[model samples]
Target: MPNEYPSLFSPAKIGNLTLPNTLAVAPMTRVTATQEGVPTETMRRYYERFSRGGFGLVITEGSFIDEKFSQTYAYQPGLANVEQATGWSPIVDAIHAYGARAVAQIQHAGALSQGNRYRDGTIAPSAVQPRGEQMNFYRGEGPYPTPRQMSDEEIIDVINSFGRAAALAIKNGGFDGVEIHGANGYLLDQFLTDYTNLRHDRWGGNVEGRLSVSVEVAKSVRCAVGEQTPVGIRISQGKVNDFMHRWSETEAGAELIFGTLAQAGVDYIHVTEFEAWKPAFGEEGHSLVSLARKYAPGVAIIANGNLHDPVRALEMLGDGADVIALGRGALSNPDWPHRVSGDMALSTFDRDLLAPIADIKAAEVV
Candidate 1:
């Protein structure tokens, strides 16, 4: 079917990859992978359908970057080893064969992990306990125990891990690009949020100090992957601890974060929200997408939220979003890219088929 929204179908360049449209399947965890964190046949088939359906790009669910703070779920996929990368190669190859681009979301759990039992270490911006029930990711009872704060040397080590992970994803996994997990108060976002970070060192305190670590990590990863790979960063005002939480203290503060990222040589900036179209700041009348576009004028901006309709996604494109990334919309309808272009409503998410990937995402999360 011809697109009523031609702008969405118009080809756009995201770094070296030229995607077919603004529609993209956002990264989402699916337990379809093996318990050891390798891609399973189910994972391959699940992703293949998205590329088959019509998404210009498909970002695999968050894969752990390091063995220590990397994985938050027992069922989550990993990019740490060659075997896992080899397992994912076919998935990437399949996406390309079907005419879609593939990207990987690299992540570390930090303190949000509650139920995940790890064989090694964990770290956070501050050791302050997250406010919540002691879920399975971290193990134990009551709210999560306070995490151990990282030393200066430890922070650099993790940044190096991110760089190494990026290199591995490109060299072994065959990913066309990568997105750093900088949102939702994970390790990077945890540092950005003052409520979570109480450090007086160069890595914390004011916005610049707090944001320094993420910028350094971005620069290193960009260098690791070289200039051609599309390196994108995701930022959000909302988080697991408090959905209503804002990463920056104010709208202007949000601008500082976005603008800093823009100056750091990131190829793209992904702004996330619970609602895609709602004003990111009720007082400023700027949605996360708009604010991002405003600050990072030169970088390609992808907006993600509750965009369950193609028409709504098209509206976002018209309003300045370079791309529209579907979250649950993609999860429920593996064929979302195709169906949405034809003006189909989002598929109903299955409660039963969810335990595979959607379940236990982030260890303590849903």
Candidate 2:
């Protein structure tokens, strides 16, 4: 009765906001911003073209929340200052004009911040050195520096910074909402994982304790943004530096994490994996999206990772993903949604395309 990709074109709800379709441009780091962390024209055109090409929602690249400690790369944008928000305003307006909702992905880099210039030091839940060297693409070199453990006061400061950044993004930059970056082994993810979070304090010990920082930040951001705005968190079992990682605990560990966030009243949870449709763990048939649906039925589920194929994307949507996020898919074809809907030929994603930056620049959009 329905087209093969009907759900992909159908409207979906995240909190009180309704998107025209289930396709979203996943948050990616595009080092096109100014050194001072303001959005640039190149970045504007990059996102604008995606909206104009018919994507339903465009999530901006991760924007650091705290100037002092959250910055991760040179030219990475920030929402900590008014000028940064002002720079993002026109880009958000352009996306809205093209009928797509724009959501800012707020982040704190923690120990993975090799390009951070605000301070000479890095801080994490614990002083552990992360598993791998920084990606050279981000201008990072050599082994990662050992980070200082975050103090209780510093933790609170980071949480408040997320709240302030969310408020600034929506109230000042005109983003439709904010998505907290609790994924990709960033600051929030550092707190979520046991290997990185070796603290015995309230912040870490077990799964529940590891999840406390993210939960608190979500509550703070929600309170700052209010009930009308959609606030979600992006989470993953893996990190950029370590892709093969998984929860050391059982599946119940995931339930506890998702359950706790849903109870905190986050509008949605974005779950990412190397393959969106595959089972989350060894021999387990349930995918992360299904797991999220099971754990947090009341919350919207956004499934990301390797969803470049139209058939696979449709299958994932059918499998209970309220929204499908495209990373490299969108990277290659800015008109991915339109092309798939119309059965048009699509471009292939080249790893070389990610050479200097994450976002596709105007010159590279052939």
Candidate 3:
């Protein structure tokens, strides 16, 4: 059969790496790693399934960058050391065997940390308490603890950790690219958020100040990986806790955020929203994906949200996105690309797949 969604299945590029298609599996937290942050055999199988299912690129779940405040959940994978990074080698080999490019999404959890084995407390740009309660699924209860404000020295160390982690990911984990987790209310987003970052120094106060950490992290990752490796950053307006957040500066903010990251030498920018097609600001404004394309013309744009529907996915490609990343859709239909191209019915996601704990189930491995 002729490919109905030509744009969605077309070949694409990010940096020097070429993808089989524009379909990518968005990074998702499964909490299936070992206690010491090492990637497990189960994780290898779980990620390999996506590649086998015809995904052009597979971005791993947010792996903690350092042993300090970067870890957010228990059993979350990390690239902090050689052991953890080396543990991912088999998984990278598996993905590559199936001809899918893999990217490691490195992150710092910062203040939203519900669990961190290495640290006694959390740290952030400021000491403000986050807006919402901890997620029950991630094994948390009650309001979040107010994080201690990070010192200047600590901030510099955190920046260095990102660079070191990126290097580790490529050197040991054998990843094709690195993605800085700057979205979803993580450490980078905490700095970007106005309420969370109230400092008057160079790292806070204004939008540029708030965005400084993310841009710096981008530069750090780019430097660590060099000019040839694909480096990207994920940007979003919503938080895992507070889902309704939006940029106050609107389009102007979008321009600054995307442009600065592109200027920092990132090869791509991944923009995600609750709904990728919806307007970013008011009822009729351009979507965040469109704004990203407008500002970062030279960089690849990956759009993620509730873009499970092929029509919506194709529409986004027309809007500005070079690739469509699916979370729930990919979870349900791992062979989404094959199903769409072959005109097969896609499966619906079952909530039981993530019930009780969001670990990778045995049934999902095959």
Q: lDDT of each prediction vs. the true structure?
A: 0.79, 0.90, 0.93
Q: How do the predictions measure up, each by TM-score? A: 0.92, 0.97, 0.99
* Clash count per candidate: 13, 0, 0
Q: Write the per-residue lDDT of candidate 3 for residues 1-366, one digit (tens) a residue.
A: 328888787899998999999999999999999999999999999898889888999999999999889999999999999999999999999999998999999999999999899998899999999989997777878999999999999998999999999999999999999999999999999999988999999999889899998888888888898999999999999999889999999899999989888888899999999999999998998999999999997999999999999999999999999889999899999888888989999998898999888899888897
Error of 3 at 203 (Å): 0.3
User: For candidate 3, which ten residues in a row score worst on lDDT?
Assistant: 1-10
lDDT of residue 131 for candidate 3? 86
lDDT of 2 by residue, 280-313 (tens): 8887778888889899978999999999898898
- In model 2, where do residues sit more than 4 Å from their true spots? 1-3, 356-360
lDDT of 1: 0.79
lDDT of 1 by residue, 1-366 (tens): 646777877787777779987778888766446777788766776777778888888988888777666676677788777877778988898888888999888887788764343555457888888766543332335665578898889899889888888888999989999999898767888888888899999999999999998899899899999999999998888886678986546778878888999999998988889987887776558788887888887899998998877778887886679989988777677677666567776667655555423453232212
Residue 343 of candidate 3: its Cα lDDT? 93
Better of 1 and 2 by lDDT: 2
- The weakest ten consecutive residues by lDDT in model 1 span 357-366
Query: Global lDDT for candidate 2?
Result: 0.90
- Name the weakest run of 10 consecutive residues (lDDT summed) in model 2: 357-366
Ordered from best to worst TM-score, the candidate numbers read 3, 2, 1
